[model samples]
Target: MLKIVVGGQINKKEIFDYIQNYYGTENVKLEIKNDLDAVMAMQSGQFDYYIGACNTGGGGALAMAIALLGVTKCKTISMPGKILPDEEIKKAVDDGIVAFGFTASHVEQVLPVLLDAIDHKN
Candidate 1:
């Protein structure tokens, strides 16, 4: 199973529910965690991926992951009004970015593509 954690400043429950409902529990497992704990867990290999959201995408969403996991391991896929193209998101996964952040408002638009990319990666 692929283990992923919802580690963001906002919409943790909603994120968890979306993944659970869409992906089901058989192949993927998700947990809601605070950003710092989520980063620590990822460091310890507790999760295969880290996802977070904030207004800016890089602030509360990715600060800890970037600090602990290094900038190379993390990517901000979306900001307030800017979201990366789908190909770029896939490329980030191929490039081995284990952590992803995006604006909370973009979750509905971003999760499907992001989750599909991750699913393909696994």
Candidate 2:
């Protein structure tokens, strides 16, 4: 089963709900944490992916993730009004983006695409 850690500075529950709705509890192990805990979990190999949100996409939500996980391992897939294409999202997965960050408003649109990419990878 895939293990994912969902967190952020804001709207974390919404994102976590979307992920649960998409993947279902049986299919993946999900954990809801604060940004710092999420990063720590990822570093400890406790999660397969880290999904987070912030007002800006790359600021508070992902700054710590990137710093700990490395720039190449993290990707900001969406903003308030800008969501990346499915291909781009897939490309990020292909490029080894284990950590994803986006604006809260885009979770509905971004989660499915990101989850799909992760599903295909396995």
Candidate 3:
């Protein structure tokens, strides 16, 4: 099972719904948290991934995550209308990015690609 924590200065409920719809509850355990709680959870090793969003792709949404997990463990997948290529996402996951951040407006494009990369990372 994959454990995920969604947080930040964006719409966490929408992100949560997308994950639930895509992976289903049987395959994943998810929680909606504030940025602080999300960071704390990651520090405690309570989640496999932390997905966060903000107005910009790499702003407040990821500040704490990057701080706690280090910049090497995080990646910004999308920014406003820009979503990275599938191969780029896969490479990030393969390189061990445990935290993903994106713009709120790009969630629809970001989530599916990000999830697919994670699912196929093995």
Candidate 4:
């Protein structure tokens, strides 16, 4: 199973909708809470991966990563490119889950590539 955690009140909805559209409503779990909540959940071994969406994608990622870094196998990915195609982001989810680590200005740029990497890894 793959677990995806979205941070921020407004941003979480946007990312959650995207995940459901691509992965199907039943395939993914949604977390609409502060980054701490998501991170703690992941650390508890309840989730396999996390995807936080703050305005800059840095704050949320940082909070989750810092919390989950030692507790669970975790990674942080960014989309400095603003946003990418939904299909592309979907494909990257698996890889993002597997890689469990990333940080950059443009998260959109690496989302697709990260997905490919995760897919290949599996």
Model 4 lDDT per residue over 8-105, tens place: 42345655565566566775565555667766776677766566555455554555565555523444444454454445445545434322333333
lDDT of 1 by residue, 26-107 (tens): 8787899999999999999989999998889989999999999999999999998799999999999989999999999898
**What 10-residue stretch in candidate 3 is worst by lDDT?**
77-86
Pairs in clash, predicted candidate 3? none
Q: What does candidate 1 score on TM?
A: 0.97
Question: Which candidate's TM-score is highest?
Answer: 1
RMSD of 1: 0.7
Give lDDT tens digits, candidate 2, residues 1-122: 99999877888888888888888889999989988899999999999999888998888778989888899999999876788898999999988899898988887788888899999997
- Runs in model 4 deviating more than 4 A are 8-10, 68-76, 79-112, 119-122
Poorest stretch of ten by lDDT in candidate 2 = 7-16
Model 1 residue runs over 4 Å out of place are none
lDDT of 4: 0.52
Cα-based lDDT for every prediction: 0.92, 0.88, 0.89, 0.52
lDDT of 2: 0.88
The candidate with the higher TM-score, 1 or 3, is: 1
Lowest lDDT 10-residue stretch of candidate 1: 21-30
All candidates in order of lDDT, best leading: 1, 3, 2, 4
**After TM-score superposition, what is the CA distance of residue 67 in candidate 4 from its true location, in Å?**
4.0
- Cα RMSD of all models vs. native, in order, equals 0.7, 1.0, 1.1, 5.6
Better of 2 and 4 by lDDT: 2
lDDT, candidate 3, equals 0.89
